[model samples]
Target: MEEKIKDVLDAYTFQTTRVCRGRGAFICDTDQGMKIVKAYHRSPQRLEFEQLVKYTIRDRGYYYVDQLLPNKEGQYLNNNKDGQMYTVRDWFEGRECDVKNAADVLAAVRQLAVLHMLMRRCDLSEDRVEQFSFQDTRQIFLKRRKELRAIYSYIRQKKQWNDFEKLYMQLYSDCMQEADAALSELNQFDFDGLRKKALDERTLCHGDFNYHQVILNRKYTAVVNFDKMHYDIQVKDLYQFLRKVLEKNNWDSSLGTMIMDTYLSVRTLSEEERRVLYAMLTFPEKFWKISNRYYNSRKSWISSVNYDKLCRFKKTEGQRQDFLNIFKYAFIF
Candidate 1:
């Protein structure tokens, strides 16, 4: 692996003293500074899209992104002998974000808001946006609801119940009931009307925004990995980060409120945006995800850890509801 990375590194003109793995990518000590060498398997078109995103962020006076480095051949990507694609970017000095810490969480969310303001200026066609439909509350809920029904049936047919299955059955009714109510509300909402308004003011979402992707030094120094960058309502990133932090904070309403307030402090959200966020927060995503992973895993036997996660989800259900209620009312039109 070192040799392969070294070979890729040779393509660059930088003088390197040492190279080692840094988290999910390779890092090197170059005369210029630290540089990250990462590889991906994306299509040429998607690569072009990300290339556009890189410059868009940089040009907007934001330098926190993983700026792609062109090799000696003047290409952003190096297709090696093994057919693997790699890219090198200047690395920032920092540590991964600590989601549990309120300050760190606030810093990351503020960075996201800044990124969104820059990305919203980019002019990408609507269809080019991956997961664009997810911005629509109706599509998001209806799709998850259908997937949940299938998983519910899959577990019901099993004669022998696993521990996960038992707890799943116990909570299935409540989860489904919540999902149904969300769907009903979504159905009555003017999805097309709100969606059109959102589209008129769309921006890019850090599709995989989380503590891991964020780097902190006093403040958030960088947000690495735009591999999941997509054209969507920017709140997608905020909603995702909120969900993750809320789970870690035991779904505490105060923490949830603090995070939301912190993010809005940097970027204001409109009523339509808040409504979409509300629907997303209200969805039974955790339950569906656990069931999805279990059913999707090729392994015949299920992992007990998944059951533990489901139990934790059940234990924290009340707190999540409380937080959601607070958010819903505070933002209610």
Candidate 2:
């Protein structure tokens, strides 16, 4: 596999004596600094769209994103063996953001604010916008609710319950109660209107803004892996980043406030936007994940440890609620 990919790399005009695998891609030390290569199946049109987005971002004076390198043919994509398409980008010399670090968490929040503003300025055509616009928050919530109901009964019917199942049914019974309240709170507003506003803003979110996507260079922070970049409410990135960090921090209120304040300093969160953000934060995403994975798994038996780990969310329920209560009034009251 390395040799084949190396052959593809050789096609590039750059001379490369060595090729080695790193993480999900290859890291090649080239005359033009170090470059990272990744191969995946993507539509030519999508690649073209990505190129324009990259150019706009770079042109707008935001140069932190990884630069995509064209192949020897002067094209952004290379069709190699197995019909795999490959593209290389300058490797970023930085460390992934440590969510546990308050400084790193706050820095990423500030970066997200700046990115949201920059993405709002990108001018994409109607056709290009239509291709990747996934405004399905309502449908997603509805689907999760359905899954929860099914999973609830599936667990209840088990004759002999394991410790994990018994605990899941116990604590998650309260966790299950949250779903209705959150949804009811959500139903009080015109969510569609907020969605339309987000669409009109033409905002782009990192889509996946976890710790790995955050890169901390000497004095600069860079974000990578834009494969899922899409147009939506700018706050989507904030909500996504905050949820992950809050979980890691055991929903520490002070840390969350500092992170939120950092972002608010850059991008003022309006009342309506705050409401939307609150809705996103309150949704039981982890609940859906546990249910979906358990229901989907076909293995006759599973590790008790794994099931126990899943039940650990129960212990953290207080922390999650406390986290939400800290900012609930920003939207609710």
Separately for all candidates shown, the number of backbone clashes (residues 3 or more apart, or on different chains) is 0, 0
Model 1 lDDT per residue over 188-215, tens place: 6675766565466666677899989898
RMSD (Å) per prediction? 2.3, 2.0
Question: What are the lDDT scores of the predictions, listed in order?
Answer: 0.80, 0.77
The top-ranked prediction according to TM-score is 2
Candidate 2 residue runs with Cα over 4 Å from true position: 330-333
Q: Residue 313 CA error for candidate 2 (Å)? A: 0.7
> In model 2, how large is the Cα lDDT of residue 83?
73
- Per-model TM against the reference: 0.92, 0.93
lDDT of 1: 0.80
Q: In angstroms, how far off is 41's CA in candidate 2?
A: 2.1
